[model samples]
Target: MMDYKEQREWLQEYLPQYMTEHLKDKNYSHFWPVLNAEWFKWLCFLTFPLILFQQRKILQWTKLKSSAKCPKKESTVFNDMLQPKRRAKSKAEIYSDIYYNKRIKPLVKAEEEVGNLLEDEDEDVKAQVHKMYEQQWRTHENAAKTNVLDDDEGDCMLDAEAITQGIDDLSIICQ
Candidate 1:
């Protein structure tokens, strides 16, 4: 087995070279600052879809000749996640929608019922959601601390909900 330093150096040298070849471009030297070993590893991982596509083309040709077929299945992680396996939504997501409807919607409706003077209601709603999310996370953290050894109930399951909500919010914001 190689030592840690040697293994790291080997990876640092090999990954970029491998990416450059797979990408079929020699003028990628300028891409070095943005592309790192981790990015190269991700690229390597994502090549499975390309391979599957190529295989599908070849299989189509053979299917025409021998009447054989390749069974189609979801291949990529993104495709699988987007396929909607009908899992239940977490409490944070449900609660975020509920709290927004309960708290923020009324404030906006009340503003609407009165007049359109407050132009910052959108900002107010965003602030309320942020504050509520922070409070939820704090509550999870406190509960986790208090029940450090209670692995049966009220352990740290709430943290997962908060994290799922954070991820959902991030995906929305990114889009």
Candidate 2:
């Protein structure tokens, strides 16, 4: 069967003259050219609803005897997900990745970096700072063994006021 474009092409030769003659009485001048080709085009378009109905009837007409092929959709290329999935991932993997990543490595790296920072200090301050890190490393080691090293820890180095208050509080508690 011929498609709408083929049917429209055949009618287009004769329909323009018929439409222009019939619609010329209206006040609109701009619509004449559009209506010429559009009338048959629309007539063909109107047939599509019927054509679709016929297609459905044909499906039912030969339900048991005939096979028809339907159009296939192209499969999409999706990226492999990153480590932290947007949805529906294992929970233990999240905590395990962070236990090593966000917690342990940065703590150790910051402690090492602070030693690098102390290299620019006066010899007296550098010696004292190095000694402080030795004590901190021992505390960190013990904390690691106990398995109670805080997951909530940030940047490893204790704040100055907290360190001072800790020493003062220790002295008070000792007395």
Candidate 3:
């Protein structure tokens, strides 16, 4: 097996030649505008060897502790490229995470608490709780409206407000 230094030397020698040949091929003409740029080629030449060095270090570290047998394979130039695995959040999930968790959940809990408070026996207490609930709701709405004026996260705040508007309408009916 080639060590890290030998592998890096080989990549340094081979990558530019391979890139030049590949770019000259008619089949890859579509990518020529990006791939043929000198800076991009230089970046690749620098980045690939560093990636190989990291992989070799990780393999050496793992081999010290684990008895697992890794399958041997021929070293190809592109074989060590890193591909990240990510699960993209859906639109609804994005909205929920950004808006519901930060803003709506507290409002919901407060509404539930107010509903419970409305069940108290004294008329004065019920009136006070109702007024407090209305005041809190208005404050929340005002805050949300102010947030809509912000440049960052404004869209998310607007969506949150839209959702709360429906809830506010429902609360009015309930009262």
Candidate 4:
């Protein structure tokens, strides 16, 4: 029911009093230019992390809980687009493997490949995976564009044996 100006005043009054300087010390009273410059610098530097913390808190509070999210059985928008990959083994087998994955110390590629396989399919349930996929897509596109200039992969060969051995040697040996 409160109007805009009233709400603003209420917020100004409700803010912490001690942290905010007393009424007598609002401006240049507290060491003026030098102290104010340092305060401005500190505020500017802290804003980035403070905003990040606020975003994390908003995500934690506003986002749906795991059980409340779209279930695996129901095909959702994301599942339709990605054509979700199926699990290779039973849940028990996979759980057992994961329990050992840390102890056994999986290779990076194996761990990454398995991670891709285990991702959720439900649209809202899997936003983090989508962001990761987008990041990886950008990295791969950058690499491919750079590779054209660098020719890092050169011409691929269908048959390594033919390239390694001389054609003349093979023809003579066969005869």
Candidate 5:
């Protein structure tokens, strides 16, 4: 069993050399360029939806097969049971849809949905500005309440002559 420090050291020494050798191979030249392209990023983005759609189809087929096999007892495939359950869309997800459509849609007068979308963004901006203003006002009010002249009122206050005299008195006292 390799400890974490030893494993890390081994990987640090070996991984770069492995990567360099792999990159030098003829097969990697064809594959490496895909990593830098926009299509590959889009393909990566689409993978989740493709996987979800496949899962949904499998779930439906499993239900149909199970119902046909035995009417009384419930029978389910282990593979189908192991499939990840799709979660309900959260507030963030709902917001993302609105945001995506707002950005993607054309700005045309006839399209009411586009007009409504713009209003949502404008309202959000206005609310954010109002919140920022309130926060600034609160900070300013708190700063005003704090005394800024405390050091000047105390014995710590001293002119250049006073400081020099105090240093001379300190030397005389020490002697």
Candidate 6:
């Protein structure tokens, strides 16, 4: 039955008291320190950047001292540390390396020989060798087609032989 003004005044006075009493209950007592920790939060916020700055200054000083003490040798220590150490090559890896080296040697040698031949001053010799290569390539291509048509089983062997012969002929011509 209180009038509006009186009700408002009563609530204003009573509400704060009610909240304080209830908020101190055992159930909510633990949350009070955390809820009131604005100063602690500000302390942390201010100190974090200071901590980082000090660390950076320390690192810089250490680096300057190191450089002054010794000229930096080509240090692979850190590089080796950062990179994973390689294990001894496996049998398969060794075999594959050997196979590739053997396979690549001839091609590299052939390239060098061809480079030498191209450097030769005689245009007629280059022309005759080119003609011979073309003739051999055409013959190989024709033989490959005939072998493919006549016998599927022997096609791979024939192609390999043709390639070997072509390489031999090229070596002879280059020499």
For candidate 5, lDDT tens digit of each residue in 45-81? 3535465664355335434643343244233598567
lDDT of 4: 0.52
Candidate scoring better on TM-score of 4 and 6: 6
Stretches off by above 4 angstroms in model 6 are 1-84, 89-114, 148-175
Each model's total of backbone clashes:
0, 0, 0, 0, 0, 0
Choose 2 or 5, whichever is better by lDDT. Answer: 2
**Per-residue lDDT tens digits of candidate 6, residues 89-131?**
8997787787866787788889899888665758888888889
Better of 5 and 6 by lDDT: 6
In TM-score terms, which candidate is top?
6
lDDT of 4 at 123: 72
What are the C-alpha RMSDs, in order, of all predicted structures? 25.3, 21.5, 24.8, 27.7, 27.3, 23.5
Model 3, 1-175: lDDT tens per residue? 3455664564445345444554344243343354336434544545465666665664454344322322223445565455443678899888888999678899999999976865765998878877999999999999988865467654554578788998999999999
lDDT of candidate 2 at residue 102, scale 0 to 100: 69
In order of appearance, the predictions have TM-scores of 0.18, 0.23, 0.20, 0.17, 0.19, 0.29
The better-scoring model by lDDT among 4 and 5 is: 5
Residue 159 of model 4 has an lDDT of 85
Clash pairs, candidate 4, are none
In candidate 3, what residue range of length 10 has the lowest lDDT sum?
65-74
CA lDDT for candidate 2: 0.59
Clashing residue pairs in candidate 3, if any? none
Residue-by-residue lDDT tens digits, candidate 4, 129-152: 778989999999988777555645
How many times do residue backbones clash in model 1? 0
lDDT of 1 by residue, 1-175 (tens): 2343543454455454535453454344454444445544534435454556643553353335322222223266887777876878899878777799778888889978766543447888768877999999999999978875556655545678899998999999999
All models: lDDT?
A: 0.58, 0.59, 0.59, 0.52, 0.55, 0.58
RMSD of 2: 21.5
lDDT of 3 at 41: 50
